[model samples]
Target: MDDQQFRQLLNRFGFSWSGYRKVRKGVKKRITKHMNALGCYNITTYLAELDKSDEVRKKCELLLTVSISRFFRDREFWKSLEKKYLPDLIDKNIEKINVWSAGCACGDEVYSFKIVWDCLRNSLGHLPKLEVIATDINPVYLEKACAGIYSSSSLKEVTEELQSTYFIKKKGKKRFEVNALLKKDVIWKTHHLLSDPPESKFDIIFLRNNVLTYYEDLLKKKAFRKILDSLAPYGFLIIGSHESLPFEPKDLIAIAPHSFVFRKEAE
Candidate 1:
């Protein structure tokens, strides 16, 4: 599909053209493959097919997904999580800590948090019981997440010591598998950001690089509000470093200027 055709598909689904612009080449390829699979000769035919079937539309959305992530993606942000925000969170919530990894692609972000938490625990003795909910709309990504294996490229930001501590290298393979220890207390679910959040209030919600990056303003605001509502008092909401909120939310205050970390102020 061409840029104009892709933009039409994105507009119909409330996705952002600017957000997908840089990565549209690969996404367009995926959509074109999907179109061919559906026996569509052109964008007009594909759009009609998408309108006629809910499943077709959903499949198209999946095809549009850009799953570009790596462990400790924003290294500075991860440092803040490890040295600053999380330490404060533990000080307040001495009993249990709940975290949500929204749009957790292939578990990289979720496992990154777990690694940080683990390192923190070892340094400061036992921490509060931790529970993490990692959600994404794509089941294929979740399956890869559950498997816990990753390519060397995905571990680029991961330091040697951290890598040794958290992952197991397979024989004759360049892939690394996340240690089983990090997998515990993590619940992987197929969830849409537009839907209601998981049952519990979260101490930390990683909404990075997804809703705010992909969706239009209306959908971004709607989903952002739901995410804000799910944050516990004084909880932190982390968005992609390059992303910004669709509108100013009175309840959230920016904690870090360089990174997109915001803290929920008490209501």
Candidate 2:
């Protein structure tokens, strides 16, 4: 597609200019692949032909770029959560523990957190129903996540001891599946973080490596505001180690190294 057409197409999908810029190379490839999938070679012609087809739209959604994720992608954050964060939170008498894993591509992070939460619950001798709502804009990824299947590499971060306890190796080559216990805790759904409102206030919102780097300052601000607004009074906001807020406020406390968990001050 021509640059103008590409710009308009991304804008239609709520892609900010900065977001588009960051992913332009990937988008070009996606558009090219999309056209090929539709049996066309030219993007300009492809857009014109598919403009009226919702089927094309769905295919295009599948073609959008994404990076692969492995379980326990960041080990230190998981460690901190286990050693420090979870203990404090479990002491509370909350009725439900809601964790919203936004941009939860392929459910690795969702499953990882679920594993930790289950371990904590078992250790404490009481298990509260964990309502973990895993969301991503892409339907394809969500489908894969709900299936609870993974390649062997997804468990690379898990130590042999934990892996033995949490995963059962399948008969096929390069295959494994989550133990039935962890499978019970997660609910996967398609959600557009850019446009949709927070479905519920959460005790923890795990929005890692994906959000901040893609958008421009204005869009980033908008996302940060959405995240802040989505959190419960004492909810924690855990982001990737490479990410940080543009401006720090007293309400957002840096509890562990490189982890900023926000809590609304008690009135």
Positional deviation of 171 in candidate 1, in angstroms? 1.2
lDDT for 25 in candidate 1 is 90
Task: Assess candidate 2 and give its TM-score to the true structure.
Answer: 0.82
Question: What is the C-alpha local distance difference test score of each model?
Answer: 0.92, 0.74
lDDT of 2 at 260: 50
Candidate No. with top lDDT: 1
Off by over 4 Å in 1: 257-259
lDDT of residue 36 for candidate 1: 94
lDDT of 2 by residue, 1-267 (tens): 667767766654445555456567777777877777778766566766667788887667556546468988878888878777777676677778899898888888988998888778777878556798888878888888887788877888988888888887878567777888787867888776666646788888887756565555666677777777777767788877667775675677777474654555432
lDDT of 1 by residue, 162-213 (tens): 9999999999999999999999999999999999999999999999999999
